[model samples]
Target chain A: MDWVSHAQAELRGAGYRPGAAARLVLEHLDREDCCRGAQEIFDALSTGGTKVGLASVYRMLERLDERGLVQRIDLGDGIVRYEAARDAGHHHHLVCGACGKVEPFADRRLERAIEAVEERSGYSVVAHDVVLRGACANCRD
Target chain B: MDWVSHAQAELRGAGYRPGAAARLVLEHLDREDCCRGAQEIFDALSTGGTKVGLASVYRMLERLDERGLVQRIDLGDGIVRYEAARDAGHHHHLVCGACGKVEPFADRRLERAIEAVEERSGYSVVAHDVVLRGACANCRD
Candidate 1:
């Protein structure tokens, strides 16, 4: 079958009943290799003739997140963005406080610090989010 | 001459109009040294007989955040929590994925990593938020 069907089957194997919204959202995320807000996903689905409710999109996103099928990024701009999990490597975000742009970034030192925290705190770090807020280059110019 | 007044003065100095909601929100934040969600702030204000809408709390929090008078913490859940910026030293948060408990933490290594990111990215790096999510001790049991 297709990638979406395979994902749905995998989720089913993991005891998650993947619905149409989940399939649609996962397909959209797969097509666009970037983070997307719930409203953005809803709008894109609607525009693409797959009408889905914002609440359903949110619910599906949360389920997908719980199942490790998606990665949720919170940039602290009152918006939560999601991207499909492919290998689910750890990353962070650089947010432009002036223009509201989000850029994904990976830092070795930051990862090392997280490992240090995990070693000291006795808390297994399942996931982490780091967002640095500042003016982007364009905004600085 | 109190903390709220000082925050208002600072906001005014930064060309921000300190509204009644902002003042009240600042007062609540100052009184409580923990992160608070918008609804929690609104309920507290309501219980204290100082009527304020949830939207107003959110707006004031955003304004206070912009003025560096408040720190917004995103625990990767849907809600964004706010705390008054005292001395405004940088810190991070450890969040319980199961119980939604948030614990504030400071790490010199994490701070150094942020400084490294600022040096490398050339972004002013006005602020940074780090959320480490895992099961707390209680939840781990």
Candidate 2:
């Protein structure tokens, strides 16, 4: 099977209810690989012929996020966005101040350092997000 | 100088706008280290006897954040919250799913690793955030 089918199967294997609606979301985000808001996803979904409603789109994505199938990104913009989590490994966020594009990244060193900081400080490090906003290649060049 | 004064000095050194309301905010956040939403801030300001208005608080915090004087944290909630960001050098966030408590941490190694990932992936890594949801001390214990 191809990667998309594998992904869909994995998600279903994890107990996600199926519909052309949720599948369209997963496939679109899988191919796009960019942080997208609900509206953007809805727009893309409609263009792709699923004809899903916005409320269902939002709800499906929310479930996906809860299931660890997606990640929610906040770019300091008024809107919230989502991206498919590449894996269960450590991931980080980068946001383009110029165009509001978001990218995900990972680093083990930072994870160790964070553990050390949590140990040193009384505050237990539970979770964190680091958003750097600046011009991206598309905006800069 | 006292800790609060030291904070003011830091802001001044960084060229951020400084004033009584800002100072008050710094002190409040230092004591709590909790993300206070803008409305909570307005309420606190009203009770603090500085005759501070909500708009003034908003503007002051905006300026402070621009200078990296404080941290603006988005909890994926509709409202963005504020904290002092004291010695907050390169930290991550941990959020409680049940209680809504947030903790900050730093992990340099993770930061570097994320940088490398961005580089290899053709993404320009600027900044990132990692948020984990779980129970906190108060909630768990």
Please provide TM-scores, in order, for all candidate models, with all chains considered together. 0.84, 0.71
Q: Give per-residue CA lDDT, model 2, range A1-141, as digits (tens).
A: 544576577667888766777777777888875678999989987886778889877977888777666767777789888777655544666677667666665667656665665556544344455565555667755
Regions more than 4 Å wrong, model 1 = A1-6, A16-22, A49-56, B1-5, B15-24, B49-59
Error of 2 at A87 (Å): 2.7
Q: Which candidate has the highest TM-score of all? A: 1
True-vs-predicted CA distance for residue B73, candidate 2, Å = 2.0
Per-residue C-alpha lDDT of model 1 across residues A16-94, encoded as one tens digit per residue = 7877777888789889867999999999999999878899899878877887778888776667888877764557788
Model 1 scores what on Cα lDDT?
0.82
Candidate whose DockQ is highest: 1
